[model samples]
Target: MKPIDPRLLRYARATRLFLTAVVALGAVGAGLLVAQAMLIAEVVVGAFQHSMAAAELRTPLLLLVAVACGRALVGWLTELAAH
Candidate 1:
């Protein structure tokens, strides 16, 4: 195998770390997205199928909002890292 240059190694390592962070953040965002989707589905299904009251869904609705915000924040952080 060819020997790697010291400067090249530093740059490669930095790139790898940045990519790793971005991927981790992206995975977090994906998980948050899934949570948000599930929450929305539950709310919709509950309302339509079970005729659930808004008061009864307050917790899940709040959680849904929180997850949506979390997903947005993660997306913003990922964009910042990419730049």
Candidate 2:
């Protein structure tokens, strides 16, 4: 048995670009998750400490939803790229 060369590995898989995309998306998703967590913490702390109303929190909630949807879209695109 022989070891494959790193450069040739890209040719070995039809989904090489797809795999690359998945990795890139995974990185983006990680950042989004961190942002989401921070947004959640801010909302919670603000609500508790400043007595912020739900209406005031609406924008942050929407931003969170957008981040989640962006992550989902990335996953979907990766899946599409695979085939």
Candidate 3:
């Protein structure tokens, strides 16, 4: 019936901090996912539709890699925080 259980707040103070970390990591992970999708779309459209050269697609491709790595890191961090 309660949004947040009062017992948790009273008995598990560390949980508040842990929950905050999890929420922040979740947001970061979601943003990274969106960035990854957008970058992939950009690269695909540039290469296939626009017939762009490799040089033109380089930046987006590199950014896509970075975003992928970031997502991995976020996942690792979430796991660490959960445990």
Q: Against the unseen true structure, what C-alpha lDDT does each candidate score? A: 0.90, 0.82, 0.93
- lDDT of the structure predicted as candidate 1: 0.90
lDDT tens per residue, model 1, 1-83: 98888999888888897788899999999899889989999999988899999998998899998998898899999998887
TM-score of each: 0.85, 0.73, 0.85
Off by over 4 Å in 2: 1-13
Write the residue-wise lDDT of candidate 3 on 1-83 in tens digits. 85998878786887777778889999999999999999999999999999999999999999999999999999999988877
- Which residue pairs come into collision in candidate 1? none
**Total backbone clashes of model 1?**
0
Give the poorly placed runs of model 1, Cα more than 4 Å off: 1-8
How displaced is residue 32 in candidate 3, in Å? 0.6
Output the worst ten-in-a-row residue range by lDDT, candidate 3. Answer: 9-18
> What is residue 20's positional error in candidate 1, in angstroms?
0.8
lDDT of 2 by residue, 19-73 (tens): 7887887788789889889888888987899899989989888888898898788
Q: Stretches of candidate 3 above 4 Å error?
A: 1-11
Cα displacement (angstroms), candidate 3, residue 53, comes to: 1.8
